[model samples]
Target: MRIPRIYSAGDLAENTSAELDAAASNHVGKVLRMKPGQSLILFNGSGVDYTATITCVTKKHVIASIESATEIPSESPLATHIGQVMSRGDRMDYMIQKSTELGATEITPLTSERCEVKLKGDREEKRVKQWQQIAISAAEQCGRSKVPLIHPITSVDDWVDNKPEDSLGLVLHHRTTQQLTGIDKPQRVCLLIGPEGGLSEAEIESAINKQFIATTFGPRVFRTETAPVAALSVLQWLWGDFNR
Candidate 1:
């Protein structure tokens, strides 16, 4: 059987015991019903995987003995940060999960003029936490040692203004005929995907003014949630780990 990989928030060191966090503990003890001596993999988003053996299991806690640490170089060479306008319902959840699996270094929930989702105060905090968990789960399943950072929701204008200076920025829109073929390879990339109703002409122009190249995958337009998956896949194949 395949050994389960669990994400633990605490520090993990070789030959040391690690107390799995409450969520991980519940997964191992209550959900999986794993017993002592069962082997598992633990990661703390440190780019290292800890080989561990279950040592204790209680109703609310699961402790594991770290056997060894192995560096897992699963990150893509081309760092991709996705700024996605929040979609309604499970669409946003699906985007976060797929973006994590696709080697997104960071994801920011963007609020665009056409965005249908409105989250504020406690609801916003709760949603960010939930989206982060989704990224963690995707990392666990996809053998990624590092979980992508999920930023709190921000407006499109604010997100564009705050992009890393060194990163190449690309905004996806159907109106643009620009493609990724002629663009020079970049060490880091920031991709902005608009909402279901799409970004306004002024919003797209604003991003373009901020040095964001308006680009498209093809003549066809993808849904807000699906664009990240397609764009990231092509990016990985062209400039990331896919060729390696």
Candidate 2:
């Protein structure tokens, strides 16, 4: 059987044993129904996954012992950061989850001129945490050793202006004549995408003024959540590890 892989924050070392955290312990015990002697994989976003076997199980805790460590090098050489305008409900969750699986190095939630959802204080924190969990789960399942960074939410203009100098940046819009394949490869890229209502013409212009090139996906219009996944897939296939 394929051993299930899980993300854990505990230190993993040869001959070391640690109790699983409450969340992971509950999962291993209740959800997976794992027991002593069964093997599983664990990663802590520390660049390697531990091959571990269950050593103990109880209602209070679940413990695993590391048998070996394996290096997982699935990351792409070219770093890609996506600045996505936040959408409503599960739509934003879906976008974040799939993008994490597709090897986006960083994600920044943006409040744009056309954005519909408004978040402040604790509610915003909660949403970010939820999205972060989705990203963590995606990394585990997709066999990625490094978890993508979910940046704090910020305004669209601020995000664009503060982007790293050497990074190539692109904004998706219907008006742009440029295509993804036409651009030269850079060490890093920041992809800016709009929300459900899409970017206002002025917002698109602001991105352009900040040196972000406008690009189009195709003739058809895509929902905010769907566009990022499709675009990232194409990008990875063309310039990342997906073609392998």
Candidate 3:
């Protein structure tokens, strides 16, 4: 059987016994019903995976003894940072999950004039934490040792101001004339995908002025959640490990 992969925030070292967090414990003990003595892979997002043996499994928690650690070589050489407009409900969740699987190094939830989701204060913190967990789960499922960093929610204008002017930035606008094919090779790329209502004209102009190229994905228009996946897939094929 394929060994189960679990993520924990605790420090992991060979022969050290670590208690799984409540969420992970519930998964191993209740969901998977894994018993003591079964082997599983544990990752702490430190770019290494630990071979662990279940020492105890109880209703409240699961404890495992780390056997050994191996560095994972799955990270992409071409890093991509996604500045996605805040989407509604589970759409944002889905975006975070798939983006992590596609090897996004960083993800920032961008709020624009067209954003329908209003988040602030404690609620926003909780949401960001939830999204970060989704990213962690995606990393585990996709065999990625390092979980992508989930940045806090910010305004699109602020995001543009922070990014360098010379970097290869792109805004996925349907009316754009440029395609991804002829662009010069960049070590890193930052992409912005608007919400369901799309970016306002002023927002698009602002991004364009800040060195964000207006790029399109052929003729058909993709949904906000689906756009990132399509863009990332093609990017991977062209510049990331998908070539292997």
Q: Mind giving the per-residue lDDT tens digits that candidate 1 earns over 216-237?
A: 8898989888999999999999
TM-score of 3: 0.95
**C-alpha lDDT of residue 193 in model 1:** 92
TM-score of each: 0.99, 0.95, 0.95
Clashing pairs in 1: none
Instruction: Give the alpha carbon lDDT tens digit for every residue of 4-109 in model 3.
Output: 9999888898889999988889889999999999999999889999999999988898999999999999899888999999988799899999999999999999
User: Which residue ranges in model 1 land beyond 4 Å of their true spot?
Assistant: none
True-structure RMSD, every candidate: 0.7, 1.4, 1.5
Whole-model Cα lDDT per candidate? 0.94, 0.88, 0.92
Task: Give the top-scoring candidate (lDDT).
Answer: 1
Q: Which stretches of candidate 2 lie over 4 Å from their true place?
A: none
Better of 1 and 2 by TM-score: 1
Give a tens-digit lDDT track for model 2, residues 1-244: 8888888877877778867877778889999999999998888888898898999999979999888899988898778999999998799889988998889999999999889989999998988888888898899888998888888899999999988989888898876668977677788889999999999999889989999989988888889999889888878877887877
